[model samples]
Target: MMRRYFQCLADRDAPAALRLCTELVEAGRSPVDVLLDVVAPAQHEVGRRWAAGEWTVAHEHAATAISESVAIALGARIPQPDPARGHVVLACAEREWHGLPARLVGFALQEAGWRTTFLGASTPPTQFARFLDDADADAVAISCSVAAALPAARRMIDASRETGLPVLVGGGAFGRDDTRAKALGATAWAPDARAAVRALESIAPPPAGPSVNRRAGIDEHAELVLRFAEFRDSARRRWAAVIGEDAATPLADDALDHALHSLSAALLTDDSRLLREADEWLSELYSARGGPSCAVPALWSALRAVVGEPLPEASRHLGLLRQVGRSAPRLI
Candidate 1:
């Protein structure tokens, strides 16, 4: 069933995908089961294919649109449940544009008997807080997919807590464990929607207390944010010099921006693993695209050079990444 649905996605056949799901539901499968078992895994494959360069970005987007449509369609077919489990508001972190995961969580919660309101993608902290003002929500759930959005997740957590609501955080940004979630002062962390449902079953509003201080290297992160444009200009120039190009292509420029964002996230979290993982992913992406082997190294060098004296911590992190790069098997 997964393979057939994936083919439907690959073929961009939304109707076929919806029919497949409908067929499953008619066969006595739960709508939520179809969603979790079929749609969710298919979407994961979409990401995997995109990362492996097996599908173009446009192809991935089209497939994702189909999957989202299927999820929404399945959601409507779910028999309305009592809001007996209390209300939960779900949102994606600011600058975190991927909302599908959060949407899945919202639907999963609905299936689990919780009334939910999904705020969609890129919700600002102030905006989130404003909504909570009139909302009778029992708790808030935040989903973030990238490390760069961790700071925004932290801000959202703060906003939820300010209203005496505990924040339940999940998604790729929090890693495979609660380390980052706890670091950001989230009330609880769940790896996925099922885990989230279980976590919320035991969740309570946090006690009134002072906020956790997770800003050990925040000054460097702030510096990166403050001088981002200047650093970009410098990195661009350095990249051209090292790569023997007059200017970077749009894709290369986007990669550079992502690299810098990862650096900023590393500094903000005081975790070098973020940078290491990013470097590894980019290396794989570049290799898959048949890009030059030096591209990733040159990117790191350019970022390192631009980092210079002002951001010693970021520089140190980049140095660690470079070491990892050297020791790892050459992707290209």
Candidate 2:
């Protein structure tokens, strides 16, 4: 099964991966085996290839699309228990397109027996709140792939709380920093879906990790996003100073690109060519500097998530999506 998955990756065949996965399941492979062994491994390999420049951004995106479809198929086969694994609605802020990690979390929870309701990438806050009420989910989880998306993630969690749903934070936005998670009033920081189940063991417990990602206010999300970015930049600068660009070259060329791309995929579109270009950026930084990439495909997904792309009149409401965070009153 694992070999079949690798074959798909080497061939850059998303559809082939899905077909092979289905066949393996019929052959009695456990869904868990498919995910832990086949699905996750193939995705990781694709990432490895992209970082090494063996694969282009386009190739990576195709691979992710195929892998996600297989995950969905495998998830469907999991015997969903009654009451629906405590309904979980997964999404990212309107400006955030990193949905792969969130999907992984969603799938993990779904397979763990949660009735997962995935809103996919670039979900508008207005709709996100509505989904919570409509789905009457037990909890709402937001994934942020970059610091820029932190403001949006904070708002989604805040709005999700109006209905009194427990808001959970995951993804790169919270990766190098958990304090932002606390400051945003996130009930918990799950890191990933598997961790989410543990994080949500009950209602938001007394934030056990750092205690800054949560707070009380309206625009607080935006303030946190700014602070998050400032902090990330500062941390990065300090690290650069200490390591000196020359010494960090290898890591910049390899690992950092992979990490940043991972950050982008969770923060940007899964199929984003822009995220893969993070490697190009890394190449420049390392020339001598380095960077990183997933998610489901959405029509106008990247445009909706990032700035610069002008939307058609029909998508004007898409701007409302960012309003959720922009409207959030900042904390002192």
Candidate 3:
């Protein structure tokens, strides 16, 4: 069934994908099972294929659109339990464009009897705060899928806590655990929708208290952010000079932006693991694409060179990454 569903996604057959899910539910499979078991794993496979260069970005996007349609259809088919549980509002972190994960959580919460409102992708902090003013929500759940969005996640958590609401954060950005979530002062962290429901069950509205403060390194992060464009352009030019203009494609540009964002996120959290994870992922991705072994190192070297003298902290972080790259096992 899963293999057939993957073919439907690969073929961009929305109707077939929806039909497959519908058939599963009609066959006495729970909608939640079909979603978490079938649709979610299918999406993960989609990502794997894309990262392995077996599918184009267009293919991934098209498949994701079909998956979203299927999720919505499956959600609508779910017989709503009476809204006995309190309301929960779910939003993706600002600048975090991945909304499907959050949407899945919302559906799971709804099935579990919580009243859920999903404010789709890339929800800004100010706008999210305004929504809470009228929402009367019991708790806020923020979803983030990338390290780049950690700062925004912190702001969203702050917004929720300011309203005396405990925030439940989940998704890839927090790593495999709640350490980063704790660093950001989130009320709780759950790894997935199932865990999120359980975590929220344990949390209640907190008493009025001082607002959660942003962590240290804000100043250095700000400095890096201010010069990001300068750093990006310098890295691009240097990379082009060394690797040829033809090699500096938009994908390469995205790699540079991702690196810088990961770096900034690392600096913000005082965690080198964040950057290392990003580095390892990029290295594996390049390796999978049959990119030259030198590609990742060259890009990092260019970034390190252009980070310049004014930002010693950023340079130091890059220097550490350089050492790691040297000693780390190379992908074959």
Candidate 4:
């Protein structure tokens, strides 16, 4: 039943997907089950297919749009309890644009009888605090889908604690376990919607402490990231120009954006492993597209030049990127 709905989503048939969802609901399937089981898995598959290059960004977007519609519909159909379980707020960490996962969790909580206020995506710490100022939320759940947003999550948790609300943090950024979330000072970590509900139910009141302003520690590569930012546009322009000269069909804006995003991700973490993975992914993507041999190298070189004096990790990534380019496929 879920498979057919997923197929409709993949085909970009929103009406069919909605019809399938309606049928499931009419057939006595739980709306929460539809959300957690059907829509969630379908969206996950869409992302998985995108990562594996089986689907383009467009396909992923189309699928996600359908799933989001289903999620909203499911939320509307779920009957709200009279008294409500409790009040909680859900928000994505600052700069975290991936909101669907958080939205699903919010819907799940709502279905479970919690009065949930979902703040949507990329919510800044100030905005989070401002929202808490007037609203009487029992707890706050911060979502971060990327490792890069961990710092923001930490600050959000701290801010929530200041408001006398126990903070429950979740999302992929916390890893398979709650270790990272615990380290970030969250009262509890919920890996999924069920766990989230449990955490909220058993949440203890915030410890009596001063309402001090706590900020996440400064990122180690902040300076390096700023340097990269200074020349980010220059790098993208150079990459496109090089790709244009070398390939019959120039690389798409999406591809160039991905290249810059990969570079930024590596810069953010100061992790050599991420840079290596980015290099490999870009190399393979270019190879599959049969783009110029110079494309990858040109990008790395432009990056290195922008850095002026490379940081220790930057040098390693630059070396790795150069190695990747040497074997990159060239268009005849």
TM-scores, one per candidate: 0.93, 0.61, 0.91, 0.71
Candidate 2's residue-wise lDDT over 190-284, tens digit each? 65556777876676533334323222222232332344444334434444543455324545334333433333332322122323333234434
Q: How many clashes (backbone atoms < 3 Å, residues ≥3 apart in a chain or on different chains) does model 1 have? A: 0
Would you list the rank order by TM-score, best first?
Answer: 1, 3, 4, 2
Q: What lDDT tens digits, residue by residue, belong to model 4 across residues 1-332?
A: 76887899878999899888888888999888888888888888887787667898888888888888878887799877779878889999987888888888887788778888989889988888888998898889899876556667767887888888888888866656665565566888888887888888887966766422332112324554565455566666665666565522345444444454445444443334445555556667666766665776677665655553645545455555545544333211
Worst 10-residue lDDT window for candidate 3 reads 323-332
Candidate lDDT scores, in order, read 0.84, 0.57, 0.83, 0.71
- Root-mean-square deviation of candidate 4: 5.6
Best by lDDT: 1
Best by TM-score: 1
Query: What is candidate 1's lDDT per residue for 283-304, written digit by digit as tens?
Result: 7877887777777778888888
Count of clashes, each model: 0, 37, 0, 0
Instruction: Judge candidate 1 against the unseen true structure and give its global Cα lDDT, from 0 to 1.
Output: 0.84
Tell me the spans in candidate 1 whose CA falls farther than 4 Å from its real position: 207-214, 323-332
Indicate whether candidate 2 or candidate 3 has the larger lDDT: 3
Question: In model 3, which regions exceed 4 Å deviation?
Answer: 206-216, 322-332
